[model samples]
Target: MPPVERRDPEPIEAYLFDLDGVLRVWDGADLAAVEARAGLPPGRLGEIAHDLDRYGPALLGEVTDNDWRASVVGALVADGLKPDVAVDVVLDWSANLGRVDPEVTEVVAGIRAAGGQVALVVNSTDRLELDLVVLGLDLAVDTVVSSARTGIALPDAAMYEIAAGILAVPAPRCAYVGPHAELVAGAERIGMTGHLFDGVSGLRAIVETLSAR
Candidate 1:
């Protein structure tokens, strides 16, 4: 049998990560508990909070975080939740400090050890910066670009460009790790190598391959 030809990996100078599903995750059980206490169906809060129409302004920074939460409360009230109860539920939900994947930090360290820069590019609300601090992730990455801060959301080419610009690397020299196929496609469209992250093990493999180069 003929020897199979091996293709060399492209040069990757930086890594861009998606924030929510890639690195940080909220507790589903806690959310369910909140819903149960509020007499709302499971996952109802997430559906209401993340509905594109209601969330767009918040993600774009056109509305304050407080305003967005108030809108959620209003939605709950309209859904037959007592106004006070809705307020309390949202307040408790807001207090949720999502757990960060420790393995992601290890992967980040590996990337940095290999002379690669890292940045978090997220489509998130205005409170993202503050949340990072509270979550003890402010220093985890070299930089962070939130859609709310820039008024540009992912899977947009411009957002990836911004992160690449910050890292002082060309988009083609960057690797983007995101949980969604749409986001990965967006990164690839802008010439970046994209990895759809399923787990830390998959991410670690990428880091190992890049580090070996």
Candidate 2:
């Protein structure tokens, strides 16, 4: 295959990124394991996992951790599992899953080497500091903004605003990269350039091209 042509970034000052599907691949294995332990069907677990992704973070803004746990437990109970079993299953599943992406580290390094500032903006229930330590992603990026800490998540616009504020750059001058189109759209809507990254090489090429431009 021919080399991918990259474009230079518009004299931008910094970069922002999303985690999960962008920097890391979260396979939802934890949710699957929880469902299996609860005796739920394969597809059923995926459905609940979708629901958690769709509603859990938003709900977190209004509910306590115990309340969120209760809600998940209640869903399991409705699916016919005992509440205690449901909670234990979920916790166990969560504990077993770990970060799977290492390419992100190189990409972050390239961005920094290019003299660009980078920050992580992720929608996560776990604390950013703890998760970074657990996943060992702290050395990859300059700063991290977790919804659990910022009280906002992707596609909300506020998360990007908060990130821009924290990075001390106008949103328009910052480039936001992620795998999700919605996040890209959100960045565009907020006046930032957005890149949908497929891998480190593609992302690095894009950044270099943008910088050259």
On lDDT, the candidate that comes out on top is 1
- Residue-level error in angstroms, candidate 1, position 168: 0.9
Task: Summarize candidate 2's per-residue lDDT along 1-213 as a digit string, tens digits.
Answer: 999999654577788988777776766666676677678887674565449654576434555444555566677778888778877865775465356476777767777887888999887765445667777777778788777776767888898888889888898789999888888999999889999878878787877766875
Error of 2 at 105 (Å): 1.4
The model with the greatest TM-score is: 1
Clashing pairs in model 2, backbone N/Cα/C closer than 3 A: 6-209, 7-209, 7-210, 8-209, 8-210, 8-211, 8-212, 8-213, 9-210, 9-211
Tens-digit lDDT string for candidate 1 (117-169):
99999999999999999988898889999999999899989999999998899
TM-scores of the models, in the order given: 0.94, 0.81
lDDT (Cα, 0-100) at 2 in candidate 1: 100
Global lDDT of model 1: 0.91
